[model samples]
Target: MRDAETVTFGGSALNRAAELRARPDEIAALLNDPAARAVPLWRGKPSIDGAGALGWVAANHPVLRDGEEPAIFLGSDETGPLFTIDLSAWQPETGADPVPASFFDATEQRHPGLPDGHRFAELRNIMADLSARDAECAATAKALIGWHRSHRFCSACGEESGVAQAGWQRVCGACGAVHFPRTDPVVIMLITRGNSALLGRSPGWPEGMYSCLAGFMEPGETMEAAVRREVMEETRVRVGAVRYLASQPWPYPSSLMLGAVGEALDETIILDPNELEAARWVSREDMARAFAGDHPEIRAPRRGAIAGFILRNWLADRLD
Candidate 1:
């Protein structure tokens, strides 16, 4: 757990000046300040240069004209006031548009108003390559903006809501209801018995891909219980003691991944076809080979993901 925050999308200590969220006067001044820089996101993709750094534009950049709403303040870094603008309203050309419901979208869209090499790229493709601060800001931006896009109505009255609290919340004019951004809790655990770790592949995962068993936490369920229940439900593997490990902010929509380690009570494998396509216990030797690209049947875990981070630490006996 000592290296908990070292995971990708970990806290970067960005000063998220929450106090200014309530002050419209100060927010207006910051928007006009020359030092204000905005990170542009298009359809959930953050604009980045060819070199993997976030593509930051001046607050008044013309490309921001395509944004569906006003920029959401991220926080202050070394680069003065930082904000994120959602340009999902902009449409890409035919054929070059993103592939719908694909596992990974490799296409990049370049706006005519932005400089060369600045393209809105998928966050997963470059998440590991970005600096800590960039990753943190990008994750926050995507989650916050995505929330605004989906939760435009008040659940209390089914009426339209207006942006409030600098995009951190929405307020319904009809019912005086205030709703805040939401992050669902998910438990991704490394389950082990003896010298092997339990890994499973979902139905749509890439061929040969396997990862720690994970599922969303249900209401009134504890993290420990979630870990045990998920493992049992997916592979029918009974897990005993569960211990908290590291965590990562997984903003592919919005989720906080709670990483844990669980001791399997038995090594039997019974796949629940609905939850997993395959499940197996992999020995340390075989897992090391997979990580090194030498295993024929098992592919290495994706870099920058909590599963890989946890597995690598478990292999090196650094889970302390």
Candidate 2:
């Protein structure tokens, strides 16, 4: 993918000053600095400004102070330091959807002090609208927030943990164990023949929508091997000569998608009964029609998603 960095959430220019994360004095000074800004997440929804862009506020905002733990060091740009705070329990204007207690809806909220006309919106609904910088900040915030929420206990000692390392680590008081945020690796491949690409639709995906075969990386598997194995398992295609192309940070709950292009040694469709509802080879012209929203039987993935970015770039002959 020639312009792979142009893919959404792939090309953030922030200098993540990791050295300063352990310097409490410096970080505290940053918190007090007038130019330091904070991005707030309320139940996974981001604070959007009146202009429909990612919104930032003074680090000293009251809601930021209300956060239970120290803010995560999101890094710094030429302007100043950037930070992320999770106020999921803060009094929002009713953010959670009416889904059962087991489900969550990030878009269901309104912030009182959001700039006029600003509202909290789900990342998926607004990812394509954000600048690359803003998208990086939001992804960072959502990922860390989700991890902290679910990993409140220590795995080693079965004890509660406390935030540490400027929110990059969790320290268990009982066992002195340390834990860090995790990024799950996923392989999404563009398996192609002369003029056709293999696509599959998972169960319950939107009608007519299909994307490249994808699966989680195993404990000791290589990226190239994962790509080949996933394609074979999902669609019974024998993929060879795999090459990595690009990557994207998909922060639904913290995932790094590794994009690859592979050669199909054999073209045979064998759908795993549990993995997909349908799998087929789509011709170039048909793929182009799907991109243009004119295909009667296929629809492309949404823009900003890794699958969509890979598919469109493949259609344009830019994956070389």
Candidate 3:
């Protein structure tokens, strides 16, 4: 977990410039500045040029028209500013098909103009391949765009909503309710007593693809408690002394994965049929085999996933 933030999309300690987002006038000024630039998103994939990913906000990207004027600004990162564009006032070019809600997948495609290795891939894949900054950009695009899509309607009064907080919040015109983006917290833990760790496979997962037992953090429950409860409920493995490990912001519709290591007090396997297809303990050596893709009966956890990361580290006795 020491190198957690080093992972792609693990967050690069970016300065989000919270104060700047609150000043509408300043944001407006930046949007209209001739020197400002844009980053076009086909869905959530960033536009790339042959010169590598074109520097956002300093080069050619998509432009958001604000009643004939450009109205977008840069989003800052740990390294510097990230280009963002507002599409509220723009229409599709003549004969050009608008990007579909699903076209976010297109950004991962290899394009001619993209800098070598600058193609869009799933965040999971990107985490394994790209730098932390690239992953952060991809995560930002996905989270912001997803918020835009889901908040077109106000949840409070079932009326329409408008963007606020520099795309971090939605304001409902009808009820005057403000809605902030949500990141659901989920706990993924490796439950162990002696040398064996508990793992489970969901019903629809690929055959033999087993990973750590996890569940969403319930309201009012501490993270450690959630890990204990989830493990007990799923595998009837009572847990004690839950230890926090690391976290990953899973932007598949916005989730923050809290990874942990739990000590199992009891080893009885009572699989909850509703929660998992199978649950059992695997020795540390067997886990190493799984990681190496040598286990004929099981597949290793998916790369770049929190589960895989945790399991790999656990196998090496590095989760301490």
Alpha carbon lDDT of each predicted model: 0.92, 0.85, 0.69
Candidate 3 lDDT by residue in tens digits, 98-176: 3345413323454334244533334443356645665666566666666677678888799988877666677898899
Q: How do the candidates rank by TM-score, highest first?
A: 1, 2, 3
TM-score, cand. 1 vs. native: 0.98
lDDT of 2 by residue, 209-319 (tens): 898889999999999999988988888889989999999998978899999999999898989979999999999999999988999999978778988888888888889
Candidate 1 structure quality by residue, lDDT tens digits, 154-229 = 9999999999888888999999999999999999999999899999999888999999999999999999999999
What local lDDT does model 3 show for residue 225? 95
**Which regions in candidate 2 have their CA more than 4 angstroms from the true location?**
91-106
TM-score, every prediction = 0.98, 0.94, 0.80
Mark the 10 consecutive residues where model 2 has the least summed lDDT: 98-107
lDDT of 1 at 201: 94
Query: For candidate 1, which ten residues in a row score worst on lDDT?
Result: 91-100
Which stretches of model 3 miss by more than 4 angstroms? Answer: 32-60, 63-74, 77-80, 84-120
For model 3, how many clashes? 5
